[model samples]
Target: MAVLPLRICGDPVLHSPATEVSDFDDDLASLVQDMYETMAAAPGVGLAGPQVGVAKRLFVYDWTDDADVRHRGAAINPTLWIAPVPAGDADPETESEGCLSFPGERFPLRRSPRAILQAVDAAGESFEVRADGWLARIFQHEYDHLDGLLYVDRLTDGHARTAAKVERKRGWGVPGLTWLPGVDHLED
Candidate 1:
């Protein structure tokens, strides 16, 4: 498996909606394995297909909750059903989120505290997941990638302005942005 090149925020593939996975074959299985390896190399809790320039509706996640239990999962053609964050479920303050696509930047964004996701596995088997707390936030973040959205895009006006300023300083928001797994500079 290879740790594929990550597409940056301005990459067209990152902005375009992904195509659904129709064939659950050896090729698809290989892509999933590669995605898992890439996510691990990124050291990110979650990653989506478009982040790796695959333009497919898939994502892989391996995250630990506050209780120290590890939860690992992969979703293909996922449909997320998010639940409203109740008055008591979480602290009212915004939560911080980072992405492999954005690399060294982390931003605070509002997300539901719970969600129910229905998706299929690499073998085309169906499954449902109900996640809450930080895990739910991870799911929502990755789900947004399938629709060409970054967590920063969900920020409020003030937060978005701050994020945009940082993005400009970082030399982002250009066409054809690409980077190696560990390299900060854009690739040719």
Candidate 2:
């Protein structure tokens, strides 16, 4: 396994919609392994292929609290469906989130207290998962990467302002000012 370099927020590849994996072969397996290594090295809960400069619908995540334990797995060609029932505050409180792509920035993100997702694994096996709290939020956040969306995009103005303030406090440049490679001029 190898640790791949994470593409920063200004990398254009992050904006490109990832292509679906057509074959589950050795290459895909290797990619998943590499992604796991990269995520572990970054010490992040979740990672997507686009963040590593790969335009494939792939992501790996493990939300367990034990940092010493390496429990990581890949999701390929994943799809999400919001739960029918409204989430209640009894589940868990919102937590501040930081992204690998957006260094030195953090923002509060509201996520479903619980969620159910259907996805395939690296072996082409189908699985249904029900997760709550931090794990659920991690799954949803990584899944959005496959769709060419970032967590910041879902933030409201207040959240965005908070993120910018966090970056400034950390002595980093203003968040969202950098032009991600493929997305630079498209917003004009």
Candidate 3:
């Protein structure tokens, strides 16, 4: 498998929502393989198709602590279920985050602690998985990318500003605000 170049925050393709996969064939399998390779090479826990200029609803993630876990392969076309919204006056604490597309930048953002996901493997077999902790957050984050949502969009003013500060400290500039990919221009 070959590592694909990651698209940065400004790319219009990254803003667009991804198209659903109509056929789970050899090409899709190859793409998933490449995604896995690319994610591993980046040394990130997750990577999505849009990050590589592919507008397909696909992503690969490996949240295991051991590098040997890569031998288990990747998750394709995963479905995600986030925890219910917190009740009134409750604080949703922010968790540190990083993105494959935005290399060299890291920030804290709020996210649910748990999630359930289902997806088909490269062979078209379905599997369901439940995730919590960092794995859950990673799943939700990457799944959002498939829908053209970035972690920054979920941030409130204070968090966004804090994240921006961290980004600046790391010598990263403000990301270009643009329409979500695959969405209508009007919505953008």
Q: What is the TM-score of each candidate against the true structure?
A: 0.90, 0.77, 0.77
Q: Please give, for residues 40-68, the per-residue lDDT of candidate 3 as tens digits.
A: 77777888888888888878787664333
How far in Å is the alpha carbon of 91 misplaced in model 2?
A: 13
Model 2 agreement with the true structure over 107-163: per-residue lDDT tens digits: 766777677777799999988777766777788888888887777766777777776
- Cα RMSD to the true fold for all candidates: 3.1, 6.8, 7.6
1-188, model 1: which lDDT tens digit per residue? 78788888888888889999998999989988888888887778988999988899999999977788998888999999998755432233557777877777776666788999899999999999998888899899999999999887777766689879877887888867777665455322
Q: Residue pairs in steric clash, candidate 1?
A: none
TM-score of structure candidate 1? 0.90
Q: Is candidate 2 or candidate 3 better by lDDT?
A: 2
Question: Distance (Å) between predicted and true CA of 154, model 3?
Answer: 1.6
Q: Is candidate 1 or 2 superior in lDDT?
A: 1
State in Å the error of residue 90, model 3.
11
User: Cα lDDT for residue 126, model 2?
Assistant: 89
lDDT score of model 2? 0.72
Candidate order by TM-score, decreasing, is 1, 2, 3
Residue pairs in collision within model 2: 10-180, 11-181, 12-181, 12-182
Q: Model 2: residues >4 Å from true position, as ranges? A: 65-71, 84-93, 162-188
